[model samples]
Target: MNLQRRAVRQNVEKSRFELPVDGEVALADYVLRDGVMLFTHTETPPALQGRGIASALIEGALLSARQQGLKVRASCSFVVDYLARHPEFADLQG
Candidate 1:
């Protein structure tokens, strides 16, 4: 069995949610306005594409937004796809 370490998500100066992975960072960029979070971009390093870091980043960001009671607008296609796959977050969309 192969066990993989989980990525820890962090907010960097309130601008982006980041997951550090092997000398790189996967990021979900967002802008908060009028009780909503506009997800602007999502990027993972090419070397870290298959590691699940992006999922962790999105999960964490969405969890944070939920905890804060902020709605989400998934402008980033990655986030849109993620939301479709994870219905638990669908209610958070604005």
Candidate 2:
């Protein structure tokens, strides 16, 4: 679905980053504390699983964190695994 080109939007009131896909929304929930962004969960619709949507969402979130000069605490398992696999973002880990 060329997810890499898709944009993720942050919903500040909800404390989540969202990516829209095929009438559904993929989201990564988080809490900002001090200077850290703690990622708590990530979800993609059942019909959208295994489509790289979650990964794209996380990538966008991490990129946004970097731009905002925020550290990251990846409590979500998916985010932990993603950070492990993408060392380029290692500097953002808090």
Candidate 3:
């Protein structure tokens, strides 16, 4: 339940995806596209839910976006809510 940033990787095992907070019970992600990214999924393993891992995943994604110079398109509700509360990330919001 401690929200820690995890490594970022396009998981080869999953083949069709990338991961933020790798190895967390669950993960969240954004799909990069046309200089922007879509926050398409939010997942928290049953054991990790309600402990803010989803938020941490979102934060990891946002920081990754900043490092990549990309804007964010928050299709995921959790990420939209995160943006609402975190104005510092406003610059990266799409």
On lDDT, the leading prediction is: 2
Worst 10 residues of 2 by lDDT: 1-10
lDDT of 1 by residue, 1-94 (tens): 0122235455758688877777998888999999999999999999989877788888888888888899999889999999999998888988
Residue ranges of candidate 1 with Cα displaced over 4 Å:
1-7, 10-14
Better of 2 and 3 by TM-score: 2
**Model 2, 22: alpha-carbon shift in Å?**
0.5
Q: How do the residues 13-63 of candidate 2 rate in per-residue lDDT, one tens digit apiece?
A: 999999988889999999999999999999989988988889899999999
Clashing pairs in 3: none
Cα-based TM-score, every candidate: 0.85, 0.94, 0.76
TM for candidate 2 is 0.94
lDDT of 2 at 58: 92
- Kindly indicate the candidate among 1 and 3 with the higher TM-score: 1
**Candidate 3 local lDDT, 1-92, one digit each (tens):** 22365543444244213333435545665566798878777777776667676676677667877887989877778878999999999999
TM-score of 3: 0.76
Alpha-carbon lDDT of model 2? 0.91
Instruction: Work out candidate 1's RMSD over C-alphas.
Output: 3.1
Arrange candidates, best TM-score first.
2, 1, 3
Off by over 4 Å in 2: 1-5
Candidate order by lDDT, highest to lowest? 2, 1, 3
